[model samples]
Target: MQTFDQVIQSNIALIQKVVDFDAKNDQLLPLDFTAANTELTDEILDDTDLFSDWVNEKLAKNNASYGIGGYNEHRTIYSRSTHFDTEEEPRRLHLGIDIWGPAGTPIYNFYDATVQSFAFNDNLGDYGATIILTYDIDGFKFNALYGHLSLASLNGLEEGKFIPAATKIAELGAKEENGSWPPHLHFQLIKDMGGLKGDYPGVCKFSEREKYLANCPDPDLILKVTFS
Candidate 1:
């Protein structure tokens, strides 16, 4: 049997666009949140408005429609919330690709799926409103998580509902609702949910990086979004 990532790689053409990747008007700009990025000070990270302004400024400077990155990144921004804190280590390794964009931006399914679960993970620095959809490809099953969404997106969702490829599923939430952070869609793919529902660890401690990363592969295999 081929691995989950391998199956996705083989069927890449079938994975639909979650964003308007081919739009002539939209541009993608890469953003960095690693410890090495000295620009993001505690003062800015602590304030959602300031952090959002910082993100938008970057996009504006580049004349881009969205700010993107953060797959397997050791982000310093998590320090702003205790939600990621543990006794042994803080969860700094990002397990998903973050697409920074305006609130209410529509998110689409990349594959035909059944709605597995949905929830409002309202914790600070959390996923906010989240949705998980199950997919099967070449007899291999997996789940894709759409996080930091507007609560309104969950208004009419039903578990087991069939959502077609490229169907609009959710919209990005505002800073006040989206984990109190800047607006962004946290997209992750999980080979195994480990019995979680609606929410999964989008970040992990450095100590268990390999374990979590194995279960959650790079979303770009399907997204195919390149930052140039």
Candidate 2:
């Protein structure tokens, strides 16, 4: 018996482009949002405008089109919003890959899937407009989540909508629409949704890292974008 990830790896060639990542025209830059970065100061994180400016500056400095990364990353940037706060502990560990780019950057369906769910998580530091698609490969079923998407992406979306492979499903949302973060697409692969609809925990408490990480696999498996 093969695991869900094993099935995905075996059929990697079938996955489609989720974003337009051109090697010649687009430079993929890896961004660090963890505590160790030291570059993300209090001023930047405290203000959404400043934070957006900082992201743009970094990409411009590196001459990159997209600032990417954040899978399984234990970050401290969540401190800016109480949305992730809990009595036990803050969910500071990221469970998805974030591709920072300009708002409205197009996003495509990576597989032939049915729209499992969609919603507007309007809380501050939330995913804002989010979409989840269910896919079947080699008889194994799973879900791919596209978060921080423009509210327009949800315009005509409905449950069980069939989207062909490589279809333009959504676009990146602006700071005001993407939970007040710098423009980026939060992509995650989930083996099981645990009966949730339209949303799941993209960030987890550090203490329960193992349990959450086990359910959420590395999104790079599908993204296939190399970084510095």
Candidate 3:
């Protein structure tokens, strides 16, 4: 079995930012609820879309990287519904690590990779703006996907653009452009997504956890940083 530590030693700083923070941070604070059993109301979840719009509007206003949703926080802080559909379903098991921060925060390439593809997902509950990078490490070819980015990030970029390690590929988008929620980055490692382009499932059902988990290992392996 490969450890996440072994796989992600090359990029530790970026990894730690995602893993080492309480979801209730002052800047990217989680919602305040009274009881543990507090169910997310439709209004709260709807704020996600409103937030996404606000992010986009702000980006248009000031042009920044602090938008919401990514691999760092998982799904808990985002208030997204629809856990993987299956028997014995795990409620909102996160498939990616979310980088919770303000919109327009700079996002860097963890390693050398080529621009695989990108798109504006545009659905109400979608990534809004997304990009994918493909690279090979020690004969292991794999991909990294950056979801919920500013529309400007896609400007002048195309497939096969050679992105160097630590290159600023894009900025974290605001909620408006990042599927309408708080600003964050949804980072995921994919082994095989069956040739899907510009989009892939970052969340999966509990019944399929074993299979999905194997295909998608902990991204922290490449990030090489711990939250705690």
RMSD (Cα, Å) for all candidates, in order, is: 1.3, 1.2, 6.5
Which residue segments of model 2 deviate by more than 4 Å? Answer: 226-228
In angstroms, give how far residue 67 of model 1 lies from its true place: 0.8
Which sequence of candidate numbers ranks them by TM-score, best first? 2, 1, 3
Ranking 2 against 3 by lDDT, winner: 2
Residue-level lDDT tens digits of model 2 in 1-228: 998768878988898899897777879888988989998998889999999999999999999989986798999999999999999888999999999999999999998999999999998999999999999998988898999999999999899999999999999998778899988999999989999999999999999999998999888888877452
Candidate 2: clashing pairs of residues: none
**Displacement of the residue 196 alpha carbon in candidate 2, Å:** 0.6
Name the 10 consecutive residues with the lowest summed lDDT in model 1. Answer: 219-228
Kindly provide the TM-score of model 3 when superposed on the true structure, using C-alpha atoms. Answer: 0.70
Ordering by lDDT: 2, 1, 3
Q: With candidate 2 superimposed using the best TM-score fit, by how many Å does residue 116's alpha carbon deviate from the native?
A: 0.6
The lDDT of each candidate is 0.90, 0.91, 0.64
Candidate 3 has an lDDT of 0.64
